[model samples]
Target chain A: MTPQELRLACRDGSFTTNTSGYCAGYVQANLVILPKSWADEFFVFAQQNPKPCPIIGFSKTPGEPVIRVGGKDVDIRSDLPQYRVWRDGELAGEPADVSDVWQDDFVTFLIGCSFSFEEALLADGLEIRNITEQVNVPMFNTNIACEPTERFYGNQVVSMRPFKAADAIRMIQICSRFPNVHGAPVHLGDPSLIGIEDIQKPDYGDAVTVNEGELPVFTACGVTPQAVIKQAKPPVCITHSPGCMLVTDIPNSKLAIF
Target chain B: MTPQELRLACRDGSFTTNTSGYCAGYVQANLVILPKSWADEFFVFAQQNPKPCPIIGFSKTPGEPVIRVGGKDVDIRSDLPQYRVWRDGELAGEPADVSDVWQDDFVTFLIGCSFSFEEALLADGLEIRNITEQVNVPMFNTNIACEPTERFYGNQVVSMRPFKAADAIRMIQICSRFPNVHGAPVHLGDPSLIGIEDIQKPDYGDAVTVNEGELPVFTACGVTPQAVIKQAKPPVCITHSPGCMLVTDIPNSKLAIF
Candidate 1:
């Protein structure tokens, strides 16, 4: 569907499904809306650590749900196909819309997502195994530390995709151009060094095949900020339901800072 | 030594030592001066295969021995510390001055060398294992095919350096900015995948220690053109001796097309 059509469907509660394969050229973002009191600390956490929490858009004022970044008509509360409500940093439940529960003090943040660069890698003819297998990219909890804010503290979570040495080099070159979307990979080869034991079993998402000669390449996942928010235990937080992202009119090509 | 001082010393035959560590900030080049009869095919070879032979400077016309690229009063025949002569693809002899043998048909081509990116890697605080340990970077002949022209046909030769994962990423980022000097790496980790039997036994240059966590990163070397020239069997070819380079007045930063 077109960006406008998708937004309208999302607005009218007609198209409440994963936004992955839809809106081909546009940027779909990971949503993170929190109370103003908690938003400040989260902003600091993101600023201190950019790779894991790249902020593509944020509310200029609390309770101002009309995000100018996604487009003039893009409303954060209704645009995303689904949302996960968090009470005291614990996931309460995945909900279709949060506008009914939305408060005047809540702020929205549209963080950059990996789907943009995945499109680029695919265009370059490099295989993204998870997409081919029709599953979410296998993600892992790593031992790598993140610089903490007052309340936010957690280990970085990474998403893994396997490739041979040559393809991994090509992936690194392609991803380096999009710093907003987690930039280049954090680690490649020998998962054990990054504290990931059993490459087949992932902390989140479905496991994909890693062939005989492939090396597992890890990128900082968009799930990292949500992971951090849970660690901080902010009173209330709302994030996009997994794979149900905020599809912005912003073209994925715009995300390339080059 | 400064660029000017080093060139002056080389000109007077007072400094016959290798030019590797001298003239730190300036661009040092791989010199390949060939007879004009063979120049057209070689130019096509370099153009068709730019990653392996990124030409930074080429003479306006066949030999009148002076090259304006290096500075005022720079004589190509004598300014480099050492030169190797090749006849019919076989090593003829080593010569400090090729003035007597310099033919009007000789066309000089100065290809960008790794010195530019080595300085870049060092500036980014990534260790160049070969430089730190005071040894030449190990290079190997790879099975990776190169784009061929007429007589110039051979597999690409690659230079290897080891870095831990994080440093390797930084190296890629830095080198990506210098395409004229063989931008970015061709491969990293498990050299055997590139048909290199053992990292310990390099076909050229002394091998250095690759630490426990480090991976071998390979780049298309400036040595590739020389390897191709040897296979081409040009009646006569003149090249700078290994470790000896044609130092240009251009600063290393000037070579970054970005």
Candidate 2:
């Protein structure tokens, strides 16, 4: 289905599953809704740490539900498959629609997601290990610190994909073209160098097998913002439920710089 | 001095040393002059195996000394600092000028050298381990074979440089922009994976230090053509002596694709 159709289904409470593997060529994004007061500082934090929190689009005006930057008639309140409403940075509910709890001071941000670049890599014939194993991409907490703002600060989190050295090089080239979605990998080869203590034990997602000769290539992850927000203890914040992204009308190719 | 002046010095029998650091920011090529009989097949070989044998320019007509593609008034016979004269695949002599042995049926091919990309990497503030340690970049014969023509067939030869993982990623991005200069690295991390038994002992150049936390990144080298030509055993073949290259008027920046 077209992104508008899919989003309409979501708005009507008919689509509540993970958005992965839907609308093959379209861009999907991680959602972030914050109070206008916290959002300004969050914007600075995102701009400062783009690899983990690249902002692709956002609400033009606070409390306005329409998001024209990413698509036509994208409502920030109910267009996504699911959202996690937070109170004091603690999960308050996983709701199919947020119109009930939506605040007048809310500012919605659409952050670039890895799904776009993953489509690019798969199109280029590179195997994504997580996709092959039918699991979430492995993610880890690294000692690599993010550039911080007064209201948001935390270490960078990274998602892992294992590839042979040559394939890893090709992967780097492909990902570099889509900077909005984490760009090139932040690190590859030794995980310990980035303070990822165990390659097989990820902090956030299920660990996929790292073959004998394959290197675990790490890209900055969107989960970084969630982790940072939790640490900052924002009074009210909202984010997409894991894998239940906001599918957009924008084609994945639109994200490629080259 | 300009490349023309440098070529004139070589022509007048005044410059007889290596051209490694000379004519900065200009292209320096690995020279290969072959009899017209062997040139055709070698051209096909170079075209098929561009990573190791990227041909930047060649003689417009057989026996012509002037190379117009890369520079003005480039006399292949004496434009390089020194030339190695080969007879039946064996090194017959190393001379400052080949005027005494210039063959009318000779066709010269200028292969892209790593110096162009090294200059690029250094300009971007990336340290080249070979330049820092003051030695030749280590080269190895890999199991990765080149696509061959009838007369030219051999495994690829690669030059090694050590870099931390992040620097290697940056180096890959920088080098990818200059495909004429061997493009991105062929393999990185493991030497034995490419058939090199020992990282400390290279088949062709001096071995530099591979410090802790550094990967030995490998790029296909110009030496592969020389190795192939030697194995092909042409009646007469001419090449630049080690570290002596044919300096051209083309700026190194001209090689960048984007």
Candidate 3:
């Protein structure tokens, strides 16, 4: 289905599944909604640490519920497939539609997701092991620290994918064009240097096969802001459930800087 | 001195040392002059294997010693600091001047060198271990086979430079812009994957320090074609002696695609 169609289905509680591989070629974003009090600090944190928290679009007015830049009639509260509600940094509930719980002071942020870059990598004929294996891409928390803003400080979270060196080089060129999607990779080669203790184990998502000759390339992940927000312990926060993203009208190609 | 002045100095027998660092910001090319009978095969080989043999300039016609595109009044026979005369794949002599041995059927080729890309990497503030160690960049004969031509076929020779993964990503971005030189690195991370037995020992040039956290990034070297030419056993061939390149008038920045 198109982004609009998929979003309409999401609004009516007819589509609660993850949004991966849906609305192909269009941008799928991680949704972050918080009170205006915390929005400014989070925005600054994103600006300071762009590799992990590259903001693509945000609602123009608090509680306005529409992200005009990413899609027409994109309802902030109900357009995403699923949302996890947080109360004081604790998982309060998982809701398919948050229209009844919407607040007039809530601000919505749309951050670029890795799905767009993975599409580009696949188009270039490089195999994505997670996609091939039908599992979530493994993610890790790293010793690399994000530039801190008041009430918004945490270690960087990264998503790992293994590739041969040559393909990894090509992937770097492809992903560099899309800085909004975490740009080029932040780390590669030995994972231990970045504090990754086990190659077969990850903090989040499923671990894929890492062949003998392949190197594990890690890119800054959008999950970082969620992790940071959890640590920051805001009064209340809402984010899309993992893999259940907010489908946008924006084309994936539109993200390429060049 | 300018490249023109350096060429003049070379012609007048006033400067005979290696040209690695002399003509900063100008292109220094690997020289290969062969008879017209063997030139077509080499040209095809170069076209087939661009990463290792990116041709920057070549003589317009047989016996045309002047490469007007690369520099003004560039005398192919004597402008370079030194030349190696080869017969039946064996080095016959090292000469400062090849003007007396130049034949009417000789065709000259100017291939891109790593000096241009190394300058780019250093400009981006990445430390080049070889440059820091004050020795030649280490090059190895790899098991990576070159695309074969009728009279030219051999394994590729690669040059190694160590960089931490993040800096290596930046280096790849910087080098991608300079395709006239060896573009982005061909392989990285694993030396044994490409048949490199020892990181400390290289087949040609000096090995630089590979720090504990750094990966040895390998790029296809201009020397691959020379090794292929040697193996092909062309009746008579002449090339620039190692470290003694043909300094050209083209600005190094002119090679950047962007």
TM-score of each: 0.97, 0.98, 0.97
lDDT of 3 by residue, A146-199 (tens): 999989998999999999999999989999899999999999999998999997
Poorest 10 consecutive residues of model 1 chain A by lDDT?
A72-81
Instruction: Give the per-prediction TM-score of chain B.
Output: 0.97, 0.98, 0.98
Q: After superposition, how far is residue B113 of candidate 3 from its true place, in Å?
A: 0.5
Q: Over the stretch A70-108, how does candidate 2's per-residue lDDT look in tens digits?
A: 688888789998999999979999999999998989999
Question: Residues B9-80, candidate 2, lDDT per residue (tens digit)?
Answer: 999989889998998999999999999999999999999998899999999699888889858888888888
> Candidates' lDDT values, in order?
0.89, 0.92, 0.92
> What is the descending DockQ order?
3, 2, 1
Per-residue error at A128 for model 3, in Å? 0.9
Which structure among the candidates has the greatest DockQ?
3
Q: Is candidate 1 or candidate 3 better by lDDT?
A: 3
Instruction: In model 2, state the lDDT of residue A49.
Output: 94
What 10-residue stretch in candidate 2 chain A is worst by lDDT?
A69-78
